[model samples]
Target: MNHTQQLVTTNPNLTHQNQVQTYNTLTFSEAWEFFFQGKISKDKLYSEVRAGKIPHLRLGTKILFRSATLETWFQQQELNSIR
Candidate 1:
């Protein structure tokens, strides 16, 4: 299995169907457009990635994030703000 597949299996937030949806990971632009929905600015996303506040993977010079991971992170952020 590949790294992405491993993430799908390990992430509890992903249903079997969602696992298929996320078989391919997301790039910064895709994640920003699809997952974040402009609630977070592009610069802030990059800053969080640099600070390791967001879940991500580094492949040489590239940064990748799984959709399931982003969903979970967003949910956690929501919960945190409520507390």
Candidate 2:
């Protein structure tokens, strides 16, 4: 089996593998860094997140986003732009 299959079959009780963990949410700085390779100004990143142009999750007053969701959003954007 490949690495991914092996990881899935591993015992769930073992934290070393087979355990998938996700961040509750990413801060603006954290999320921006993932998409952008270089330095990004805080003001611009915050503006984009606030404008609803970016995908995000809001829990009460807190803001968070799943990494996988962000990736899916990017893929959709690419497909839409191509058509």
Candidate 3:
């Protein structure tokens, strides 16, 4: 799986050591690892994704996820369960 690069500033105070940190939005497997605390099987995760129950993105033919957004989705799911 390929990762999309994200540029983030590490330190704003240090001008001389200014550097941009590169991060990859989570892959399908990596993202699923956080889903339901990884209690579900990979096949089940894929099924959920296919059923549109989980949030994900398709870049061309590649499935990907934004960890922050996915986490928020999970939080909402938890809240819904409570209600």
Candidate 4:
């Protein structure tokens, strides 16, 4: 199988996690991966930011997020589902 196919078939979850780890607010790719993990579509991410559902910091138009915040958000989602 091709490299991309091999990656997809083996530990798909890990692959995604790795992608998420590769970036932060300092890198666009990392930010995209984090949003992707949250299952937020690109359009939806923008919309949520616009609507104030998702909190972000703006440094002269550069958006940033804390990794811990994303982790907490995911944990809260899990907790809500358990109820």
Candidate 5:
């Protein structure tokens, strides 16, 4: 009946919650501010989202962009720009 035993004997949702905590999702505005900075303007960011070129998650009316995926996209963009 200790802490470890209590967690092991209890609800499984706690593990799932911990899994979810590891991922970082950002809003469109936050994603641009954090990742793009001076590289991409706000207008272009919204345009890409509207054009469906950006990877995103739609939850109800809100949009979320994954930090990892956005970083990958930025790397791709850099590669493309060199060519």
Candidate 6:
């Protein structure tokens, strides 16, 4: 197997990051791994979602987040931190 294939096998999250744009929304796990790059814990993410502190949608038992929404949110976070 080549390097790309090796990476895919070793880190499934890389595959999700590559394919994130193709979807309109992302599952909870995919959103954190792709956007936060695992900088934050899953519990933090879940807490944000539960508290409505993050941009998200609820489909029955599943939670979904939009990449565009998160991109803007990150920018806002940066701006807030500068103040």
RMSD of each: 7.2, 9.0, 8.1, 6.3, 10.3, 5.1
Q: What's the true lDDT of residue 61 in model 1?
A: 85
lDDT score of residue 9 within candidate 5:
37
Please provide, for model 2 over 1-83, each residue's C-alpha lDDT reduced to its tens digit, 9 standing for 90 to 100: 66644653454554421122233345555566545423667677667779997788788877777766777787899999999
Q: Give a tens-digit lDDT track for model 6, residues 30-68.
A: 788778879999999999889998989999999999978
The lDDT values for all models are 0.79, 0.61, 0.62, 0.59, 0.70, 0.79
Error of 4 at 7 (Å): 16
Question: What tens digits encode model 4's per-residue C-alpha lDDT throughout 1-83?
Answer: 65644553465576555544443442333455544555667777777667966557777867777655665676887898999
Q: Give per-residue CA lDDT, model 5, range 1-83, as digits (tens).
A: 55544653365665533432344787776677556654788899888887999888889877799867877887898899999
Q: Residue pairs in steric clash, candidate 4?
A: none
lDDT measured at residue 31 in model 1 versus the true structure, 0 to 100: 75
The residue pairs in collision within model 5 are none
Task: Give candidate 1 regions above 4 Å deviation.
Answer: 1-23
Question: How much lDDT does candidate 5 score?
Answer: 0.70
Instruction: Estimate TM-scores for all models.
Output: 0.67, 0.56, 0.64, 0.57, 0.62, 0.73
Better of 1 and 2 by TM-score: 1
RMSD of 6: 5.1
Report residue 15 deviation for candidate 2 (angstroms).
22
Q: Model 6 scores what on Cα lDDT?
A: 0.79
Ranking of all candidate structures by their lDDT, best first: 6, 1, 5, 3, 2, 4
Q: Any idea what lDDT model 3 has?
A: 0.62
